[model samples]
Target: MILYIKYMVSLRCKILVKDELIKLGLHYVIVDLGTVEILENITQQQHDELKKSLLKSGLELLDDKKSILIEKIKAVIIEMVHYAEELPVTNYSNYISDKLGYDYTYLSNTFSEVKGVNIQQFIILHKIEKVKELLLYDDLNLTEIAYKLHYSSVSHLSNQFKKITGLSPSYFKKIKMKRSGNLENT
Candidate 1:
């Protein structure tokens, strides 16, 4: 049985889910982002227990088909943006369609309806967040960050960064440095 989880986007969330499954004595075959496959049929008691336990941690057990599908899309996007070592060379639409085995139009429409943002916009937002994280690390230059995230060029990254954050990358970096007491870096 495949169980879908809402907000299972991070390593910590995955660990929390595994711990919950273990506590429930539920044998799980696989636990990936937003999903868990179990080896046995779940009784209502077990399901409710798991659901209640997960809820205590701010996670949710998804039930309806649309919610599951939407969570799946979110999981894929989160993995792609925040976790993947390299972004796919293919366009976002095709990458998402192939990942979810649904037509891009359906996925796009569903995501827009549920999230109030198109998938591409969602990707941009996530990418910008990742950019901010990388900047905080002070490990990579803007060019390298742009290349790692597969931006067409530094200008493209800067444009999207400004659009999403209302601050240019350099200005954002300066703010972070000043806040961290590294004014010399700024």
Candidate 2:
């Protein structure tokens, strides 16, 4: 039995789903983001119980094909941005199409219709979020972070970061430091 789950975006979400399956005494074959495969077929009652359990943990089982595809797209993008060591050499549209085995036009249209943003914008948003995460770590310099995120240059990274965050990277880092210091004092 295969289950398509919504909002299963992080490692913690995967762990929670795995724990739930174990609690239900269900053996799973795979538990990737947004999808799970069980070793045995489950009864309707078990499915219902599993659904209820997932819901309690803030996850949802997707039944519709379109919704499932959308979740899959999100899962792939999240994995690429947050987990992958290197970005694809090709353009994201080509990469996404090849990865999903769907035409770029169809994927773009579907994602835009469902997400209210174009796929490129979605990728940029995720990239920016990743940049923020790297900034927070403070392990890399801006130039290094820009290269790590595949930005053309530090200026380009700073420009986009400022456009999205309303503050330069340095300023953002300073603000975060201030907050941490204040928290320590409190």
**Best-performing candidate as measured by lDDT:** 1
Write the residue-wise lDDT of candidate 2 on 1-186 in tens digits.
Answer: 889988656779999999999998999999998889999998888889989999999999888888998888888888888899998878888988999999999999998999899888888889989988988975998999998888999999999989988999999989998999999999
Tens digits of per-residue lDDT for model 1 on 1-186? 999998756789989999999999999999888899999999999999999999999999999898898888888899889888888889889999999999999999998988889988888889999999999895999999999999989999999999989999999999988888965557
RMSD of each: 2.4, 1.7
- Per-candidate TM-scores read 0.92, 0.91
What does the lDDT come to for candidate 1?
0.91
Looking at candidate 1, what is the lDDT of residue 162?
96
The per-residue C-alpha lDDT of model 2 at residue 183 equals: 100
Clash pairs detected, candidate 1: none
lDDT against the true structure, per candidate, is 0.91, 0.89
lDDT of 2 at 87: 83
